[model samples]
Structures are given as structure tokens and as C-alpha cells.
Target: MSKRKLRVGLIGGGGIAQAVHIPGWNNLPEAEIVGVADLSEATARKAAAIAGTKEVFTDFHELLKLDLDVVDVCTPNKAHTPAVLAALESGRHVICEKPLAVTTAEVRAMGELADAKELKLMTAQHQRFTQSGVAARAWVDAGKVGEVYHARVRAMRRAWLPPSPGFIDGKLSGGGPCMDIGVHALDLCMWLMDFPTPVRVSGTAKTVFAKGHDMPNLWGEWDRERYSVEDFASGFVHFDNGATMVLEAAWMCHQPDNEELMAQLFGKQGGLAWPEATFSTATNGIFAQGTLTPTTQVPHPHWNEIAAFADCVLNDKLSPVPWTETIKVIGILEAIYASSNTGAEVAVKG
Candidate 1:
């Protein structure tokens, strides 16, 4: 007798779902995507076809009717909360895309529901599944970078502003570069630091170049009138452990690199940088600097992330990227926007 395959349902059958997530679910022999839901019927049909399933729905609620073991949410930032809450309520484990809910309140709502239901809820932060990221994390776990005190994170793009309404519209996407790209680097940084409690944040968010025609977008033009979110944001964070961090994110900036995504951690014993996987330390009055090599290669981080989520559900293990850690990430980001609005330091809870 063969083991029954884990049936999965997909919410938001858009680019991320079709491009990486659908293929990711397909790659796992123990799991299969049974249905796909999208706002557009055509998109839902397209994603369903790719998943080799006939189940397609224009409404996610209809997809939720299926006897699915898991729900993968690839929706835009704003839609995450409702979809995740619904999936949790339906007694299904869930994996949602980054910036999980844009705010801590929404994160708590979904998180608490999942906890009550005893279902796994994971955030799809694929950067942490990369080869370099794995190597850096192992090193940090081994106390290579002991007692981290300060960190620097950046997610800057020269001129790659996504022209999509879901990205530019604050009502849909919640925030701009801070929430879109900044969340990636910030999450990785905090994860490496063992998720220190964020106490306060002071930041600035502005729409510097998206509305203007001076800086041409590399990904093409976006609607100037609908561009309500900030193109650039920066923040200073203070943690409960007396640690501090400086973060910067931008969609358009005058930089040498087309895009520079980085997270560097400074500690008392050593300093480490991610993606680059470089580390520096001094012992016995001698300087040592070297790159950490991963024992295994992760060419497809998205697939690994999908596999990790599925494995947790199948084996009854803890979620790889739990909501507790995610709330801290969102809390800092929410504080950044709050501080930006009031021009004052915002206190972060939890």
C-alpha cells in the first residue's frame, strides 16, 4: 500500500505561486497541490494547470472547502491576514509570503488562531534557506559571533520599482521598500541574533523618486498618481539586550550596484556578514578573516522553504519560521512607519 499524498491548496495564483511555489510543491512526492484560487479566473486556471489539477476557484474561500492538509498563501501583503486566518480556522497548516501581515496586530490574530488550532504557520522567508544563509546561521549558532551588539541591514535598489498596483498602492501593499525588501534583510538579521526583543525604533520613510519622472525605473514605469507608498526608508532599532541596528531600504537610489541586499552583524567576539558568508575575528593578537562554506548547496531556496514547511506539517514538528519570531520583525517595521509619521521614536511591543 502506498502512503496517501498530502493535499495542498494555493491561495493567490500569481507570479510567485506559478514561478516558484507551484513547482516547489510539485517537487515533493509526498505532497501535491490540489487546487488554486486567484482573483482572476484566468490566473487560477493557469496555476491549476501547472499544478496538474483541475480545481480552480476565483475565491479563496471556495478553495478552502477542499479537504486540504496545507494552504500556501502567495497573496499580496494586505490579503495575508484574512487568508491565513481562514486557513487556520479551517484546521489547515499555512505558509505565507514575507512581511507576513504588514502589522503586528494582524500577525497576532493569525498566530493566535493557529496556536489555538494547533496548526503550523510559517512565513516564507526564503533568504534564510540559501546556502550562504545556512552557513552563516550554523556559524552564528556555534558562537562564532558571540554577543552581537550592533548590526547593519540594507535592501537598496538603483531603479527597480515594481510598477504593479499591489506594490505601489499603500492600501494593498501596506508600505513600500521598507515592507517589501527591508523585511527580508531585517528578518535574517534578527534570526541570526536569536530574535532579540525590539524595544524602540526611529525611522524615516519618504516618496523621493517614484512620482518624479527624473529617475527612470528599471522595471518600467508605475502610475504616478497611485504611487502612495514610500520609495525609501531607514531606521534605527534598539533591542532589549542592549543591541542596536541600522537598517536602510530603497527602491530607487544612486548606488553603484543595481541592487544591494546585505545584513552584517557586529559582536564582541567577532563580526559576520550574510549572503557573503564572511566572518572576521582576532585571537592571540592575530587577525583572522575568512568565508564560511556551506556543507550543502541550496540552489533553489524557495523549494527548500516549501519542503521545510511541508515537512513540519507531515512530521508534526515545529514551524521552521514561527509567527512569534515574525511578529518581532513586523513590530520593528510597524514602528518604523509609526516613527516616520510622528517624527519621534516609536516603542515596539513584543
Candidate 2:
């Protein structure tokens, strides 16, 4: 008596695909993963097992031949553009992992293609689905944080460098922590600020501790020879609306905290910070501070993200995290690297 479930095909069966994405799809009763494709047959089989489907393929293009309503791309950062383009051209809605594309141009092309095809395309910015993020957004939207003019964003880890060629290699990962965890806090802050247009950026990306043995990694030893990306990056952004932001990302630092992912916003009326959901302001001419509490916890933010994407696709709703927003995020990141290379403030083209 029920209509058919939305058929899905997965494009890369790596750790993210197997651990969160596939499981997220399995949680949606209105969706069913029909097939999985990975370069490794073993990885494909492992993901297909989780999807409860034996259909597996080594090439994603082969899986695209099937009747699929959606394609979930869990590939490495550099591979996201190609996979997303192929999926959109195949007449399938797409949900891709974050830092959707390394370059703003690549994101624009993919976004334009999806627009022409009239397909739903969402970037997997799972942090937005977190309780803290959701709560902060609500407060900001309610004018609690009025006219935010500046923000401090950080995604620093003491010694949690990812141990993989896909992340360490510049050709694969595009950059370093700036693309990895930095995108998380940056995206959240920008979203809360209603996505200001970044006009210019000055940044520095360096291999301070990654290429040396001074700092030991908590995630175990990685190939220092293959590590071609920056271990630390800092940037300053000026927006069209006169708003400013300070961004910092690092895989390894001399900090005591294991991690310190934060986004602190300063506004005309008040100030707020995330990953803590705390706020400060002057009410009735007196100083006041409070913590924004989550009405409910998101047990699995990735699952909530998947559900939202599927809902938008099935119901003709707007993409919860559209490529338009993602392009802006990528533009800022791209400008950071460009500024670092040229030793000058780089203009971000909208």
C-alpha cells in the first residue's frame, strides 16, 4: 500500500560511507541503498553489506546505469567534483561530503550543472545538524545576536593528524586542516551570519610541525614524505558588508586541549560562541551571560543531514545545504591559499 522507496547508489565506500552515510541511509525508511561502488572491491562489498544489498561495482559510472533517485558521494575532497558532476548529469540528486570542492570554480561548475538539471545537490556539512549548531542558528535568527560584525573561528587539534594519503597528499585532499575541520567551523559561522560575501582574504599556510618530528600525532605515525599539505593555516577575511572574520586551523599544535573547534561571533547587540552555545550581552544596562541550551540532542547529526537531503529531494523542497552556499565557503578557503602563495591580500570573486 506504500509507494516505492527512494533508490540510492553510493559512490565511494570509504570510512565515511561505511560508518555514517550508509548507516544514515539505512535509517531512512523512505530510502533504500540499491548499490555501492568503490575502487576496492572489498570496500564495495563491505558497504553493500551495510546497505543490505549485494549489488556492488568497482566503478561508480557502472552503478549510475541503474535506476537510482539519489547518489551519495563519499569520496576524497578532490574527487567530489567529478563524482558530483557525473551524478547530476546522470539525472540523480546528490549529497556529497564537505569542502564540496577545493576550488570555487569547480563548485560553481557543479552548482550550475545541478541547476540546469534541476536536481537537488547538498553538501554534507553535518555539523550544521548538531544540537549546538541548531541552537545557535535559532538564537541568531531571532535577532539575539544582532548585526554580527566580526567572528573568531578555530578548528585546532593538539595531535590528531589524519593518517591517510587521501588527506595528506595535496593532489588528493587539496589542502590540510583548512579543508578538513576548518570548513566545519567556517561553514557554521558563515551560515549563522547569513553568508556574508567575502571580498578579500590574507592567510598563511605552513608545514610547521607536520614535516618535522617535533610533534607526535595521536592518530599514529603518518608518512611525512607524502605530507604535502599545510599543518597550520590562519586567515583574515573582509566581507562586503564590512564584517570581518579571523580563521585558524591546525592538525597539530602545542595546545593542551585535545581539540578546540569554536566559532565566536561579535555583534552590535550581543556576542555568541558555538561548540559551547554560550552568549554575552548587556540587558537593562547590566551585563548578562547565558548558555544556549539545545532543546533536543542530535544522536547522529550525519543521519539528520541525510534525512534532510532525502526529504528535500523527495518533496521538491530546497536543498538544506545548497551548492550556492558551499561555493562561498570554498571561495574563502581558496583565497586563503592564494593569499599565502602570493603574500598579498587576495580578492574573492563571487
Candidate 3:
């Protein structure tokens, strides 16, 4: 007798879906992508072919009707709340891409509904599954860096702005680099800090370069008229624990490196930087600094994230990236935008 395979359905057959997500699901022998749904029939068909499934639906509602144990949402930022809520209403576990939703209210609604329905809801923050991320988490958990006081996060690119309406358009994407790449580093930093409650936030968001032809984009040119979102954003956060953080993100910047994605934590006992896994501390009146190597290396963080989610579902365990933690992240981000708009420090409502 063979074990029954988990039936999976995917919503939104876009680039991320075809590139990493479809491959991640296919890598799991115990999981089967039973259907794929997209607004475009051609994209649905293409993703269905990649998933080794003939079932394709132009409407995601039709995909939800399938006997799916899990729903993978790869839709645009604006579509996440509805799709995730609908999937949960249909009695399916859901895993949504980063930023979960644009607003804290939407995230809370989905999270509360999932709790009421006793279904697992996870956010696909893949950076937490990376080799360096895992090592840094373990190191922090072991009390290497005690009493974290402040942190710095950055997700700056020289000129790699995504040339898509789903990203650059404010209506579709909600925010700019703050919502796109900034969420990646911000989430990682908050997770490392064990999800401190953000009490207040002061920020600035500006359309510095996307509107002009001064900076040539590395990813190709985008529509200047359609570019409504900010090209750069920065925020200062105050946590409930009296800890503070500085976050900076940009799609175009005059920086030396092509890109510099970092999250550095400063603590009373030590300081640590992620991706690099470098740490500094004074032991026995001697200064010590070294790079921490992960005991295990994850070649594909997305695949590992999928596997982790699957493991939790199979064993009836909690979501690997629960919504409770996600809400805090979204709250801070929402406040950043609000602060930017009002030109005043706004209270983070979590």
C-alpha cells in the first residue's frame, strides 16, 4: 500500500510560480499539483503543463472546487487577501507569497478566519529557510547575541527595478520597494528578534529615479507613466521592548554594489549581520569576530520552505510561518506608509 499524495492547487501562474514554486511542488514525491489557476488561460495552461497536470482554470474559484489539501497563492500583492480568504473558506490550508497582504487589517482578517476554521495559514518568507538565515537563527536562539537593542536592515539595488505593473503600479502592488524587496529583509530581521511588537514608526517614501531617465535599469526599462510607486523608502521603528530599528529599501540607488541586502542586529553582548553570518563579541576582554557557517547548506531555500510546510501539514503541526508573526511585520510596514503620507510618526496598530 502506498501513502496517499497531498493534492495541491496553485493560484496565479506567473514568473515566480513557473520558476521556483512549480518546481518546488514537483520535487515533493508525496505532493501532487492537481490544478493550476490564472486569469490568463495561456498562463494557466503553461503552469499546468509544468506541474504535470491537465487541469487548468481561468478562475481561481474553479480551482478551489478541486479536492485540494493545500493551496499555493502566487498572485499579485493586491489579490492575496481575497484568494487566501477564499481558499481558507473552502477548507484548504494556504501558503501565500511574501507581504501576505498590503494592509494589516487584511492580514488580521485572514489570520483570524484561519484560526476560527482550524486551518493552517503560512506566509512564504523563503529567506528564513536559507543557509545563512538558518545559521543566524540558531546562533541567536543559543544566546550568542543577548538583549538586542537596535537593528539595521537594507534591500537596495543599483537599478534592478522590476518592469511589471504587478510591482511598479501602486494600485496593483500597494507600495514600492518597501513592500517588494523591503519586506524580505524586514521580515527576516523581525523573525530574528522573535517578533517584537512595533509601537511607532517614522518613514519616508519617494519616487526618486523611476520617473526620470537618469538611471538606467539593469532589469530593462519600465513604463514611467505607470510607475506610480516609490523608488526608495526608509523607516525608523520603535519596538515595545524599547528596541529600535532602521530600514532602507530602494530599486534604484547610487550605491557601489549592484545590490546590498542585509539585516544587522546590535545587542548588548554581541552584534550579528545576516547573509554574511558575521558576528562580533568581546570574550574575556578579547575582541572576537568570525563568520558563522551553517551545519547544513540549503541549495534551494524555496524548495526547503515547501518541504517544511508539507511536513507541518502531514504531521498536523503548526504552520512553519504562522500569521501571528506575519501580522506584526505587516503592521510595521503599514505604519511606514502611513507615516510617510502624514509626515508624522504613526503608531503601529498590531
Q: Pick the candidate with the highest lDDT.
A: 1
lDDT of 2 by residue, 1-350 (tens): 99999999999999999999999999999999999999999999999998999999998999999999999999899999989999999899999998899999999999899999999999999989999999999899889999989999999999999989989999999999999999999999999999989999999999999988888888999999999999999999999999999999999999999999999999998999998999999988999999997867899999999999999998999999998898889899999999999999999965
How well does model 1 score by local distance difference test?
0.95
Candidate 3: where are CA atoms >4 Å away? none
Clashing pairs in 3: none
For residue 103, what is the lDDT in candidate 2?
96
Clashing residue pairs found in predicted model 2? none
- Which residue runs does candidate 1 get wrong by more than 4 Å? none
Each prediction's Cα lDDT score?
0.95, 0.94, 0.94
Backbone clash pairs in model 1 (N, Cα, C under 3 Å; residues 3+ apart or in different chains), count? 0
Give the runs in model 2 whose Cα sits over 4 Å from its true position: none
Note the residue pairs that clash in candidate 1: none
